[model samples]
Target: MKKILGFAFAIALAFMASGCTMMKMGTAFIKLEPETQEAYAKMMDSIDTYGDPAKAMMIETKINDDVTNDDAVEAIKAITEERNMRVTGDVKMFTKEDAAPDEVKHARIISVCNLTTAKVFLNHSRYYGGFMPCRIMLVEYGNGDRFLITMDLTLAIKGGKPLPPEMLKAALIVKDTMETLIKNGAAGEF
Candidate 1:
């Protein structure tokens, strides 16, 4: 009986050690928490100013039109409406264009969100509120230039951490919807 007890104890220690190794391996890859501001900034920085995605999950598409910045805004609006998403905000960058309107280019961002998806994500982690109301940016070197920019949903969600199964499903929904918007926005189709 004493020998059996010793064997059991040894087996338990081995299991514990294996568990610790697995935990350490997981931690070794976590450079930074995905939900932190630093992570966010890093992700954004991975993309170029012109909408080209570098090391980050942010996606960018060049606009090859000779129209105006307003075109990008309209494209966002139409796509959001078609996809049944809500337009939360439209921000104009370099509002100080008064400093030199023609000296630079035109840039703006349109924020959109679907309440259903937001609710799912929030239920999983309210902190995600920071990324709420996803954004679609329209960048034009000149008035008529075109570029479509937005976060990559898969990358953003995965970065946050392995979400609960329900949250994962919701994230995928948001991802597919966002992808549709990006494709349509880039193609200038609703």
Candidate 2:
């Protein structure tokens, strides 16, 4: 009886240690302005209607003028290559949206990228048991040359759980990257 109890305790401890939300990152949440929130929502809707991702999970986007220029594109490409992400399709961008001004006051574009993580297979049964983060970059050239843009990152947790810290860190990175692009005018292209 004693050995059985000890074994059970050990197994429980291991599971607890392996659970998600154990990874360490920066803060847990990142706040956004009301306008930013609305913009993000609209972008998500577009992704759903246009991209049709099976799990359109994490989304991160930024609105900047020519932000996807050589440098910015290279940065994103590097992340994809380093992470071994399979680009499901070529990056697609929309010239305009439903709510855009009739006169096309600003340059509004939407770009989409897809990536995947490891999958778990058990006796011929395959399952999505890892975290696949999805990112969307939205660039909007507002009036006065003020760029209103943001990135939305979501973790498509399937069969397994995701560490809160890791998710938070990824989110912060997306937000910070958007802020940087806006401040510098799309990789300092301004």
Candidate 3:
């Protein structure tokens, strides 16, 4: 009995250590050079200023230290999977030097929306409060290049309902605003 308890304890300790390691890794920030960090900061700031008509509604952009681009992608997938929303898109990268005029630098745009929700709920699904999904946009620039990624996220409703069209529109506007900042050389200014 003593030997069995000792083995069990060892297993528990190992499990705990692994869990801790995973948590640490998940919470860690992606390492960026000083210039890169500054550029990101400025680009975010420009989001509140440049993008189309919504620029007036733009407030100060907030940067989340714990929220890495990879984590954002995973979180959206995990959250939507519970609600039967399958994330199907990917982040596409664009460099400034290679991009055309009036283009963005280091842009990654991911589109994650629920076709299932729309098919099931139709127009009435917009009334569901938590059903309005989210889209996460991330942009990184360094070594004289910029990158951006966007992903859609949503929650499952009890009735298999979808988010409202207006909600989706707003999310798109926000993304466009970010793109505008990149186009205006916000990355270089930072």
Instruction: List the candidates' TM-scores in order.
Output: 0.63, 0.31, 0.33
* Range of the 10 consecutive residues with the lowest summed lDDT in candidate 2: 115-124
Output the TM-score of candidate 3: 0.33
Candidate 2 residue spans exceeding 4 A from truth = 1-70, 96-116, 121-133, 142-190
lDDT of 3 by residue, 1-190 (tens): 9999999999888987876666666444343222444444444565656653333322222234444545544544554455444555656555455644445445554444456444444455454424333333445544332233222121121112233566455434534433332222222321
What range of 10 consecutive residues in model 3 has the weakest lDDT sum?
A: 151-160
Distance (Å) between predicted and true CA of 90, model 1?
1.2
Clashes of 3: 8
Candidate No. with top lDDT: 1
Report, for all candidates in order, the number of backbone clashes. 2, 20, 8
Query: Candidates 1 and 2: which is better by TM-score?
Result: 1
lDDT of each: 0.69, 0.40, 0.43
**Which structure is stronger by lDDT: 2 or 3?**
3
The parts of candidate 3 lying over 4 Å away from their true place are: 1-51, 54-63, 96-105, 120-135, 141-190
- Return the candidate ranking by lDDT, descending: 1, 3, 2
Residue pair clashes in candidate 3: 106-146, 106-147, 106-148, 107-148, 108-148, 108-149, 110-150, 112-152
